[model samples]
Target: MTSRFPTRTSGPSSIASSIRRPAALGAAWAALSTFALSEPSFAQNAQPPVTELPEVTVTTTTTAKKKKAAKAAAPVAASQQAATPAASAPSAGAPAPGSRSGSLSVPTTAEATAEINRTPGAVEVVPGSAYQTSTPATTIKDALDYVPGVFVQPKWGDDSRLSIRGSGLSRNFHLRGVQLFMDGIPINTADGYGDFQEIDPTAYRYIEVFKGGNALRFGANSLGGAINFVMPTGYDSDLFGARIDVGSFGFRKAAVSSGGVSGAVDYFATVTAQETDGFRDHSDGESIRGSMNVGYRLSENVETRFYLNANNVDQRIPGSVTKSVALNSPETAAAGNLLNDYQRNIDTLRIANKTAIRIAPGTLVEVGAFNVDRHLMHPIFQWLDYRYDDYGAFARLSDESRIGGFANRLIAGVNLHNGNTDVRQYVNVRGQKGAQTVDAEDTSRNFSAYFENHFFVTPDVAVVAGTQFLHATRKREVEFGATPGETEFNLWSPKVGVLWDVTRNSQVFANVSRSAEVPSFGESVNVGPTVIPFYDIKAQRATTYEIGTRGANANFTWDLTAYRSEIKNELMCFYSAFGNCNVSNADRTVHQGLELGGGAAIAKGIIANGANPDTLWLHASYTFNDFFFDNDKDFGDNELPGAPRHYLRAELLYKHPSGVYFGPNIEWVPEAYYVDSANTLDTEAYAIWGAKIGFDNGGPITAYIEGRNLSDEAYIASASILDRANANSTLFEPGNGRAIYGGVQVKW
Candidate 1:
């Protein structure tokens, strides 16, 4: 939270005096690593007739022990270009070629094999120059912690508790069965909970994870599916940016963005603010966000776009902490500030619009609309006193054609959600004198219809299908207890897949899908009316299967996947006393997993024998999940609580020569790994290694410094299950130790 460093140069034109040979600035940083593999638009707007794009500055050295590279000094002409806002365009990656109309800027493994060979469910995409030299994360679950079956646990620091595949296994707080979007609106909560501190994850430029039933193009009752966060448009980042970060417990962050064009219109906007002082005890929080996008150009085919997102947050709620206070001291804190000790505020809003048309010539058509609002302020414990307000609206239409020999595409959608909540209760004794209020009023009505298609059977092979039809209604009215209900459920989910391009790089895919879940409002009215009163529980079905393969050229690359799912009713969670909790429905369940990853550049004579074109990259992954529980008898074979069968990550990046850059990484998880659900004790397997260094001058300023866990390993990125009478050897969250940070960045 202290910036100021311009021993010369400040915007306009800089990058060390605009490339004055260093081999043309190493060919303009390899053309910015292929312009950060751009694709995934929506970044427009920035001053008069849209000029933006020209602002880059970063500085930090409040006692430099190590980490100095703030660069600055290079500004001499080309007044503004635009595009780099929207919270600094989440690290802008690029995408804007044919710009809209017939839009096609594929890549990200050909958009995950064209949505796994033509949609039908199950998808994945994580691109942004492949996490452009990571180590600059501000959520988005810490850059999806190395993707692969995603699992985010940020506890008190920035509040995140995501789960994919096993979607919010039983939830403790945020996220429930996936479903989160940005650009197409919807970020949960409107009765369909989801919260990762309104996600800022560095403002995103690419991140699409649809795991079951291909998320029916968004609006298919998530059973762990759907996640889209893309931003960065306007002819591939025009430019004008900003970024700043200060670390350790009392962290701080700031972001900015601005894009190009104006007149024919094209825009961008991004803003962010963050704060943290968490490590337990009275935590502390602060959040701010803003996003904007605009585009127009109604001729030559057609194009239209507009998107806006906003968020505000306030926090303070530590709670969970044990395991002998997390290994003798996981930063202790949380000893009853009781009565929920108040403090938790949030506000969110979203708006969207999209339009694309191209009468013929490859043919294409797209339409979209969106709206979402959420509000929450909760406080309670003695019994349960909550408050919430939700809202929703959505619409979509899609088409892509080629007729002639065969080539087609189509998608359709609709959604409208509503919400309500206001309840109170305080009196489990403890100086009880006055307390008792109610206002259940709940409603979650949904009507959905979806379809997808892709068939080219030849010319590289292709086959994909899709389906979805959901009509749901869940009403609750308590005015004051006693019989208040309304339940109506009707659902259908379908998906099929096939994709074999075996050549043109590589490919393979498979799919089978179905999912339905319904039951909230504290899982059907948290006890009362003498037990089981306001009923409406039915709709928890699942059946998923997946297969995968991936490939890339220019020196090797890879991706692999394998999955399985089977569920019925299943929605268990019964934890009595202390933080109580009870959500029924559990009869059968099974889920399998396997995901291998790849990345390579292993010296081709150090950049094809030309010496320092530098190059050497490697990436890795492994997941084996096995969750089980069939015909429950109070939790069977155990091992079904929060991911862990083996999760791994590895990295090594080095790109040097004048602009230098470094990397080293490893993250592991082992140990019996049972943090709850009657899984008596377990937790071991640990590994840690981290390193990063940076310096780039292609314009604006660039500098970096990082070191995490660097051997101080006392791992536990997530844990929960404290007190099973030392029998469970109690476990409580504990992660974060061994920190080192450095920052400096500026763009314009």
Candidate 2:
């Protein structure tokens, strides 16, 4: 009745990645049994149109509404939205203001799923065709692995450690309480910290998640909330394209893209490059990225867009061991990190602009500005040189009429981030750079303003409200020591909610909120002989309670949620050193959760000749966490470590309608969780299985093959946190054992 992995340190060399796991599962079940005995051709598929619903609403017009709008067109998206199609009305070239689905500044994906179905709480819209036709999405946990209460892991190359709900359970590295965006600008760094390898998950085109406080349209007041990737415009991309990928430790990648539009202008662009040679040992990495955007049209109620981005990254650092050396040797390497050659490199550039107007016809307005230039050359344990100069601005206003006549909507926004940093330190000799110890300058400023409203009363109800107001600042200056000074904050956060619509594909919501976070600069750095230098910490607050339900028909679809939070001062770190980190504050805490995602269509004509027939799908997601501690005098109520109280993901598929799919997936963690807070170190609970085969017809051609951890399981995909530990804790990080991957894409 006692054994949470306590001995075993000699294993892990893995027969060269398990000998390509049976010729990649024998060519993925011989291409799924020769494509299930031939039968393909869907008359070049169709779908895409439906982005017009304003003029104070009221479009009905049915009588079979032009025969269900020519049987609902087609293209892009359908990897869940319960197989698309729903939420209608608005067609007839209806986009009289700077097109692109009636530009409210780029939306589409059915206006971002009708603004996350009028948000009340919890939101998500991941659909890059759900993992680009089947995984290996080069990180960000393969594009938010089924996003149910979001947790994300990957901790090497494309570095990750995302959190939402249990938001940053004790500072680990980089990232803290989420917030990152692109196309809505701001990519965290004005004291808030972020670097998820500058995100290039194949250059997005669908990704938005606004949890807690529903992120009030990006005026994000953390507690793990905002993420917006969205990119791909020239009206939804693909005028030209190319892709390539190969896998298993030594992975490779290549990419190209282009987009167009003439007269009134429009554009899109992309470029990528990659490298890998990791699976532990020094954990290799490399990257190159690019993106572009352009749009114009100054009449027809105005429009404007312009943006560019670039990045270069290189990483190497595979340190974190003990748990019996991460379950028996786990590719050893961690102890001065390869004799001090640990690394992290980056370079970046960004520029932005946005504009929109349409002051009437149900109103709209937008504005923007930005600038970023970063560079960091780290060699660990000090040999860090940094430089950053962030800047930002934004504005928004949206309105949908009918006040005394009921049905109303309004949104407001403003945000500005400011930054400056230029710090340097040396003395790592092996990774070069000897003498000099510290020199500094760090500054940050932030201002945010937000508002939201929806007033319906009935007609399927609505009553949601919002608020956010923050003003922050932090400063630092040093050359020798003692100057852990300057800090200020003015916070306010509020929210209220209610939304219903029970049928017509279900919905019901509830909310109660308030959240705030302030203290990034990795806890407002000090580096002196500290006895205190969290700059008087304080500003973590929370107050949440949520409820949820989502719907779909024609064989079912779902998304459920539940939440609870009650916190204060919760910014923890509990001690560390490999070059400082002691962080502070924690006097109460509690976070609760449950999320479920769905898809069914369990069976139907397994192969019934033509006209798109053949079905059988089941995709699932589940998450349940219960973070805690509320009664501390040095840890009393316990239970607050690093995630995993229970998590699950499931999949099963076989769908042919000529967009082939093949699946088998599972990732489970049944129990065992604790990484420290004196919960006394623990970890051991596992499940991993995978398979894939794909072909997507949203194109000129597409292909895929995948396999992972096919039972070569050695588990532990993440860990790193400490308050106390035993059995010589180095803090695990292993996972990724059996693998194979492949890809191809072309478009025109």
Candidate 3:
């Protein structure tokens, strides 16, 4: 297939108009050094003389009294044991004696990290506490800033583009390819579309990122794998907490939460409100979010839990502008956006339940069900109103035991998801509905079964294998059109890998896997002069080969991976003369990349040593993406449009024993990258500098001040629709200018 898109010739321009002053950098370093040397150490002050504090004395009890007390406590101990089932009990980070090797259980932070290191592919775990202090904590982008192989850039408010290993590079709207989950519950709709507005950064205890086929445990068969956000239960959370944040551009936020346990029941709840008058015109928004969960112990072998989530988001759209306008007049909004006051407003609610039962020693069974309702109101070139009802159910079984003196584990699961969308469109008369233009009903269904096993060849070596079978269907009933359309697809994906323990804290591994993605209803809709039904488009598929190593020690930690994928029938999109999008499939493409991330303590105990030593730390993440067409009929060996070839982020900070710290960071793109599939127009290479200072004593109070884009450089943060070069493309989203923000958090 050939596209009639026009091509153009252009050269890259300088992206950085200015750089940080030498005096500013010098002053920051000097201040950090001075504080590290002069501040009184909290560790020193925490020590006390043996005679300074009061002492308590215990009296010995008689044998007769002890016997009576023991008799009274026996029944209470038995009742406690009955209420806290082994299957639902809090994680202890280890299996019981004589238990099977495949038993499944929730893991604490330390245990989770260890498992991530042992996996045979790229993976990461981000602790929520790492960003809970002295940060804006506004969007998912903030939490994943330092993760390599991931590219996330904000459009306006909380809306952003998230790509993993070049996945979803052609998607200019909501997310695709990557699976999202909240507390093990699917966050994406039945057709695999997800939005960031429903995610609250403060609501998670930690996040697990499974890159590529490593996410087999969750039945995610997409190229980007999955990301799961884990929330804290009442047993692991604070009793009370509150936070307030204020910043540039009329930004303000407040949040409060409570968690507690009583008898056999535990509950956790949080509410947050936020608003911002964005940096550009027609870019203002507000949101309110609520999340809650309750858990009850049923018996010594079973437990159940329930969850609820609600969100109301109202955001104005700041449409993309021309490249020159984006660089020269960064704060200016697109004329169409200002005139029509384009906006995306949503109201959503979700409820879910999950149960766990221990059927036998070292064996567990889990089942869950969820329902979601959402309404959307949007206005741009047309007025759009959509309502969606989505629901799903899932079940999983796990067993861990020794087979013939060899440790082994097995995991199996099944998932079912279904949804229906009522879509309506009308002529836009200054952002108001004029006349009904189109009405349609879209339905989707998905069912999947997956199984994985890990067999230890030796104490230090393991072989892993998994497979998933998926059946999906999409149907669209055009009530206002002449014809309706429907499509069905079935696929089987398989994976195999090996892991070798090179040492106690390090491992080496390799894997090969296959992934497939079925097009959504939006991708099959007909528009413009092309009246051909998009149901003719085939699904995209890829086979990937990967290898990596990861490890952590007392002072240093690192993760690195390299992978290459050969893709067939890759989806590509471009603009038509009417400004509408036309989607098609490319014949062949190749995606390959290298991802690296690590951190180290450069200097320890500059002024003092021992427990609370003052240290200087350095952390860095880098990605090398090489994605292109492989001798295609139309665009032969052209580079992919969105991401750059090389991207790097690094930070250096000085810490004091008294919980004060200061840091400087940088986001650098050292090479210009193409913005069009024609390989004509491109983005300029640039570097940005930022700094932050904060005090966190691991106590009830924490505070911090942060600044970004300190040099006020103008650069493109992201882009829109893929197209051939046109002087009026309007495809650039400008990055925000210099700004400062501060916040405080308290808990008891």
Candidate 4:
């Protein structure tokens, strides 16, 4: 595949090529040595004993009480067994249920971490409580600030570019490549388009991240893998809670939540309202979001849950600016954005249900269904009005058994997703719809089936294999213009891996997998000159190889991974003079990276051992990215734009037994990175420093004050578009300036 646009022939001499083989080897050795030195203390601490934690009732209801009485009168042997304290404890390597104050429908944070560690692929779990205690929960970036290999930068309000392992690097608006889910229900549309506006970080109990093909179990077939946000249920949440936050740039937010359990039923709900007059021109916005769930315990071994989510978002767009302008007058809005009054407004509602049943000992069955409705009103180069209705269903079965003295596990599942969208475009009359230019109806249908098995070669070793078969179709009917089009795609993805336990809490793993992504309708919608049907565009595919190790003990924790992916038919886009993008496919490319995360307690017990607080602690996350196009027809071995080669975030903190803590943090980009595929434009390297002071005791009240960009550095946060950028290229998003924020929370 080749592009018609003019290209600049540049060799592999950019920032990505500066690292020679010797340097790579030296870095690898250094990382290995560091891991070795950090291993001893962690290994000395043993795993905690398995035991049942006490349960505390937070609320009661008459209807729930009657349901519990009816269930008690029924014959339920499985329920009886599950209720037994000794029988309820999870087996070794199994995820544990949440605490009594946690949701009964899902595993606790520690349990999720343990379960993720068992996978022979890259994955991580972040506890929600860690971010909600005393911090600004305004954006997804705030919650994932320390996750390695993930790049998150805000554009306006909740809209942001979220890329995992260089995934979705080219697309400048909305999200692709990465699949998003809430409690196992997909948040993305049936065709794999997603937005960050629907995610409520404060509503989740914990978040799970599966990188690359590790997310096959969830039917995610994309290079970026998937992220699942698990919400807390009534059985595991506080009865009442409230929070208020005020920050720089006219930011204000308030939220309230409640959760409780009564007899066999439980419920949890949260609502938040926020408004901000942003730091940059035409970047103001407001939003209101709510999330709720209710679960019923049919028996000790059977449970069902229902979820509801709603979001109303209105945000202005500042648009990108020239690099020179971004670094000089960072607050200036793009000229076109100001004239057109570009904006994005959306209203979304989602409903989902999931049920789990233990048909027999060590065997389980799960079924789920979801529906989503969304309306989008956007104005930029053109006025866009779109409506989407998406729905899907899934079923899964899993069994764990011992065969010939060896432990084995098998999982099989199927998913069906379908959606219809009404697409319309009109001339922009100062953000108002004018002369209609295009009208169409787009429909998508997707189906997938997968199976996986893990057989223990030894008590501490296992062999794993899995495969998924997918069939998808996209249909577009142009009601007011050119001919209609329909496209069909079929693919088979396979995976194989091995896991070896080095210690009770540590393991090493390796895996090879294949992933595929189909193009969404947005990719095929041509708007500028030379408009042509994109039915011939092919799906992007990649074969990835990965190796990693993860472990945690009382004093330290670490997760490190190295991966390389060879890709074909990569979905790529180039921008026109008017800022409109044309999507196409690249012949060949490579994405390789190293992800490292770790935390250690340098000093402890300064105040009292019984209180168990660290006097000094350090935590860090680092990513090294090397993404480049192979010898393509246009760009020869040039590095892909969007992400930097080396990025790091680190922090050091001091804690007192009295629940007071203070920390300093740094965000650094070590080298300039290209802003266009032609390698003609780049963003300068930068380092920013910040600090925070907070207090938390797992109690009723918590508070925090934070300062960001204390040095008031003017730097580029992100960029977009263009195949060949130059001095006049307007493709830079400026970083925020110095700011301070404070927040408080109360719970009962």
Leading candidate by TM-score: 4
Best by lDDT: 4
Candidate 1 residue-wise lDDT, 425-473, digit = tens: 4443322323665546676666677776766556545577778887877
Please give, for residues 1-748, the per-residue lDDT of candidate 2 as tens digits.
Answer: 1211111112211101121122432343243232111222111001112234332212234522443343234432244332332322112222221224533467766567656667876787776667865665778788777778898878777887788888876767778888888887878888887888888988777788888778877766789889888787775666678789888888888888887555466678998888887888888777888988887766656778888988877777787787787777777778787787777777788889898887776577898898888887777776777778888888888777666767667888888989888887788766777777878788889988988887777655679888889999888888753354778899888899987655444555777888888877666333346455656787798888777766655665677776778888888766665423467778887877677777777886778545556677787778888777778888887888888877887778776666677878889988878888879888889898988877764546677798987877887878877767777777778787888898887766
What C-alpha lDDT, on a 0 to 100 scale, does residue 28 get in candidate 4?
A: 53
TM-score of each: 0.31, 0.32, 0.85, 0.89
Residue by residue across 1-748, what tens digits does model 4's lDDT show? 1211111112111024654233453465355434432232222112211233334333446644654455334332211111111111113444432122233346666667655665788888777765776468788888777788888887766788898999977777889999999888888888788988888887888789899899998765899999999888876577788999999998988999998787678889999988888989988888888999998877766778999988877788899999999999999999898888888777888899988776766576889999888887788778887788889999988776777867777889999999998888889877667899889988999999999887877766779999998899998899785457999999999999997666655667788999999888766536557564567778999998887777655567677877888889888865444554566788998888888887777788776566354467677889899988889889998989888999898878776655677889899998988988888889989999999888764446778898999999999888886678788888898988898999999876
Which stretches in model 4 have alpha-carbon errors above 4 Å? 1-104, 524-532, 606-613
Q: Give the Cα error of residue 116 in candidate 3, in Å.
A: 4.0
What's the lDDT for all of these models? 0.58, 0.72, 0.72, 0.76
Question: How many residue pairs clash per model?
Answer: 48, 5, 8, 3
lDDT of 4: 0.76
Worst 10 residues of 2 by lDDT: 6-15
Ranking by TM-score: 4, 3, 2, 1
Q: In model 4, how large is the Cα lDDT of residue 367?
A: 92
The runs of at least 3 residues in candidate 3 whose Cα sits more than 4 Å from the true structure, single-residue gaps closed, are 1-107, 115-118, 481-483, 525-529, 574-580
> Sorted by lDDT, highest first, which candidate order results?
4, 3, 2, 1
Give the Å error, residue 248, model 3: 0.7
